[model samples]
Target: MSRSLRRGALAATAIVFSIAALSACGAGNDAQTLGVRPDNAAVSVDDVKIQNAVVITQPTPGVKGPAVVSATVFNNGRQAQTLDAITLPGTSATVKLKPAEGTGPITVPAGGSVVIGGEGNATAVIENGTEAAKNGDAQKVVFKLSRTGDVALEAFVVRGSGYYKGFGPSEVPAPPSATPTASATPGGEHGAEHGGESSPSGEASHASGH
Candidate 1:
């Protein structure tokens, strides 16, 4: 065999080995399993990943309100898992979670994911934040997983207005306006009776005067 041929063959073999190694290491693998967060705002641990975790602010400071946390939890493990709670470190905000019906914690199906902060299902509610979490700020929080350990990451603070309209702490939503109902006149039947009785009295007075 020629030296050039041997060198070529060696190069080919090295390339093959490198490809195999990357495959074993899961090149371009799913974010959940690899614990490789997609965005800088994302974090994962033990196949349980939370992406885009954020706190929706109450817009104005000194209002003293709770901010809501929104994130998409992905469980890449073979078994199902639950999210027990999430805590914001170094902040006055308390965590309030609305668990899935019949499940105490947020449940993630095997190989499936669940998205929080939407209008539908229960989500993490950050209660009693005085002035810590402000608009355009970032807060670090730790997620307590049922199977996996704590996964901590920074969550951005967004004002719940304009693009983030309609998101805030749970409040007594303003009651819908009552639609105008078709009914009688402004004074009802009493005014009509009064007008009729007044007309007769006026006629009697006119006759008495005549």
Candidate 2:
């Protein structure tokens, strides 16, 4: 073979090897998972407060649909705040928050409160606050208030059946057969009966994984 041809072939071989090495490096990087987090993802309870009273309003019973919940985000402090997107305190739980669906990124003004919910029905989603409360996990609505830096409000999930006050570890939730009846009972009675029972027992109350 000609000397010139040999040099050309060597150069081609070198280029092929270099390309292969780069490709391998790229693949390795791709194989390595990137650190990711949900937006406003910090979940905690130390800094949050019940700025507004935890309220639970029942939809007329037998309404066969996702419950609608509304909460007012008030920045009682002087500074402005931003709410991180909300999440359930469990793995692989599917839920939703209202106002977020229609109004989007709820920005609470300093020393003021904004109603977070959608039209008519507020934000709709399978709620997990009650579940989290029942489980006794850190009960919080993660968000960044204008005044408070990233925070998770000590929250209570208001359900048609009843309410869950989050405080300690996971809760011992009421049974599925009992939830509807439990909620339907008079509010005062329900409170008296399950007043001290706050938490998500980390158990599924229904097939919805709630």
Candidate 3:
């Protein structure tokens, strides 16, 4: 084989290898982008993992409303862990936890998980002080655990609609009913009677003058 032909063959092999390398890199990038992250927030503290942490609020425009915390608490330890309370930063809102059974702290069993704000599950409500967070906003939520301590993360705020229709706080105060205004004419019958009496009085006065 000629030296020039040998050099050309080596160049062709190098091009093929370069193309293979690029293809591998592209596949790696595609694999990395395969899965979508959860829309809600999540945090792991030691053996405790808080997944799908979200705040569902019933807020109106410019008015704060009641809210609830929804998440799944997973305990990977050997013993059960209790969720004490959840708190919001920079707000006076108080978080009240309602266990699934009895009036006790929410407990996640060992090597198991507890769902919050789910059907027939534990509930964490933000009572009294309303949540001012609007839909699609991120609010900082601090989860207090028995052993893991406090794990704070910015959870996404969603409205109590669609997928979260029944996830709102149990005790959302109803808006004040508008007081009915006193009608200018109290009753049609009363106004008619007054008109009739006034007309008769005017007619009698005119007859007397005549």
RMSD values, in order shown: 20.7, 16.3, 20.0
Question: All candidates' TM-scores?
Answer: 0.59, 0.35, 0.62
> Which of candidates 2 and 3 reaches a greater TM-score?
3
Residues 84-146, model 3: lDDT tens digits: 888988778788888877898888899988878755678877774354455777889998989
Top lDDT model: 3
Badly placed stretches (over 4 Å) of model 1 are 1-40, 60-62, 100-103, 172-210
- Candidate 1 vs candidate 3: which has greater lDDT? 3
Best candidate (score: TM-score): 3
Query: Sorted on TM-score, highest at the top, how do the candidates line up?
Result: 3, 1, 2
For residues 1-210, could you state the per-residue lDDT of candidate 1 as single tens digits?
999999999999999999998987775565546433344277668798777666766544435556677677888999998778888888666788775354477787899887666455456767665455766667888888888979998877876555344434443222234222223336556656554432211000000000
How well is each residue in 147-168 modelled by candidate 2, as lDDT tens digits? 4555544444444333221211
Model 1 deviation from the true structure expressed as Cα RMSD, one decimal place: 20.7
- For residue 210, model 3's alpha carbon misses the true position, in angstroms, by 93
